[model samples]
Target: MANPKELDPAESPQAFYGAELRRLRLAKGLSQEALGALVFCSGAYIGQMESATRQPQKDLSERLDVALGTDGHFTRLYPMVTRSRFADYFTAVRELQEMARTIYEYDPVLVPGLLQTAEYARAVFRAFDPLRLAVETDELVSMRMERAHILHSPTRPRYWVVLDEAVIRRVTGNARVMHGQLAHLAQLVRSNRIVLQVLPFSAGGHPLMQGSLTLMTFVDAPPVAYGEGPYRGQLIDDPAYVENCRWAYDLVRSAALSHEASLALIEAAAEDYASEQD
Candidate 1:
């Protein structure tokens, strides 16, 4: 058998947690596959956690406690690991986005990060971390922009977005920035690169009113759903849960304007922002 790669726990909390997990699993003489089976995730997921490429979810942590007989060692460390990672829940989502054949999203507030311009993204990062210094904000903004590269790839997922009217009307930075952001969205829509829909406020009290949700479908693997809030995120892969979220997303889509109408609404909002900038 090959020797395991060295793990430097001093790198980060995730590294410490992951190295400890690997040590415990190895001491128990369990293969990654066997361990993942006990924890109800994939061997690949276990590998990612052990390599510190992915932060273990709370559910996974509890299962690991029971499986490895760690008596809550992993569970107790879950929150600490999350605090040390940026976009904690999104790490897996980003991986899935690359492999997904279709990506569907519904956002009730700000624009989706996949479509955000640099200026808009910076403004969002600043708003999200009001106490963060410029260097920290720049790092996050760069990461967000880097993730957008999936859309620019030659073979990309078919992206469909249902944005609440508020997303278009709300200003992220200055009026000029908002105008540029909306204009960018409009160009993407016109180019057939993405499908855009606006869920009008007049529709009122529709499904997915509570928070934003992303449903991703792959050619081979099972579908997944990701729900996001201001400060927390959850990745749901259970078939039943993902199905219910998919159903709710369909309802939101039904309540949204048709593609052409939605494009017109977006463009109109951009013009409104441009006039204000004047």
Candidate 2:
């Protein structure tokens, strides 16, 4: 087998955590598989953590600490490793989205962040936290815009999204903002950059009616499911749970309008917004 790559702890907090994990495992004379068994995770997952390709999760860190007899060392370091501009729970989702080979998303109330325009995102942020300062909102908008850059890349993930009709009807910033956002979606659809379907109100209740869901598949890693609500998000990597999420997404897709019809509806909504702006 090829020699394992050396980790540079200076690279980032995650890298540092990986390095520390490796050090403890080696000190205990344990192989990745051996350590993984102790922690109740797969050997490959341990390797991914050591390579800084996967962020360490809180519960896993606690388990690792107990398994390695680290006296809460890993648990204490978990927060630092995950700290980012994005919410703690969303940091991993953001990282995985960039590395995914295919992405399937379902949102009930708002446009998915990957497809949101600057104005639309800004308005949503402001509305969610009316007391937030302008500078804070600006910072968030910039980060979100930067995240969307992956969609423009040549190797961008195959993106498919199902949006509830409410997403299009609700005026987010203003009439003009809604018009621009819908127009942008139309352009993306027209350019074949993404596959989008609208889950109309007429479809009635669905499997994913409770909140938003994102399912991402990777070339080298296992698939993951992310579910988000107002302020909380959960990322699931367990094979069984991820499979269930995939099934739910498939159901949502089946209930949504066809691509052509969805585009027509989007265009009609854009026209309605345009008229309101006038």
Candidate 3:
């Protein structure tokens, strides 16, 4: 185990994409602002997409290829970079996933990001980096689905997650995929390896009204709580802060449906979606 090689900004894949985007922009004599205006996105979004800080969606991907007149490079570049899950911002997500012995997750909208179905996860990923094609979305989805293997490892962590009822009801993708997703959601619930609870909208004015959070406790260090929004994320390591978040989670659990009851809710939703499919 020697020191790892330092990565140069010009040598990395991100740099490659960024440099190429910049070259195309300069070659066309278009400013970032001008390119952003044409794409119907912000200048910063254009910058981020070019820097490979975010993936471009299908429409944007095609637009870039045509806008830059690069036969097909940007179109091909979109998926080539979009397939990675944590990407450049949340490398810690993967690091934390590997470190924790017990993972406590609270998802107020959809399923805990970790427990998302392929389609659901893809939708989430697509929502982040909107210019990827279906192939890229599928690739990213596959990468995320494979991450669930941690649940079955020889020394699996104790994973407890709470979901908002709307998560099960908010169908993602087509009716068939939604049906399959609900089934997968129910199957995971029945595995007995996890304790999952669902908080309904009817349980109005709940304690944690904002969004999703996760408290991951490592065997060797103090517990840490991580929170995320659609575009931002934070990792909390301080004892007082983590404790406060844990307390809030404990109260949320009290207000949510019991584990068995939650499973029933998920099962019923799965059947509902399944019935529609038949």
Candidate closest to the true structure, highest TM-score: 2
Model 1, 202-230: lDDT tens digits are: 99998799999999886544677889886
Which ranges of candidate 3 are over 4 A from the true structure?
1-89, 127-130
Evaluate all candidate structures by whole-model CA lDDT and list the values in order. 0.85, 0.87, 0.71
Score every model by TM-score. 0.73, 0.77, 0.66
Per-prediction tally of clashes: 0, 0, 6
lDDT of 1 at 11: 76
Candidate 1, lDDT over the whole model? 0.85
Q: What is the clash count of model 2?
A: 0
Residue-level lDDT for 245 in candidate 2: 91
- List where candidate 2 sits over 4 angstroms from the true fold: 1-20, 24-47, 51-87
| Higher-lDDT candidate of 2 and 3 | 2
Predicted structure with the largest lDDT when compared to the true one? 2
Cand. 2 TM to true fold: 0.77
lDDT ranking of the models: 2, 1, 3
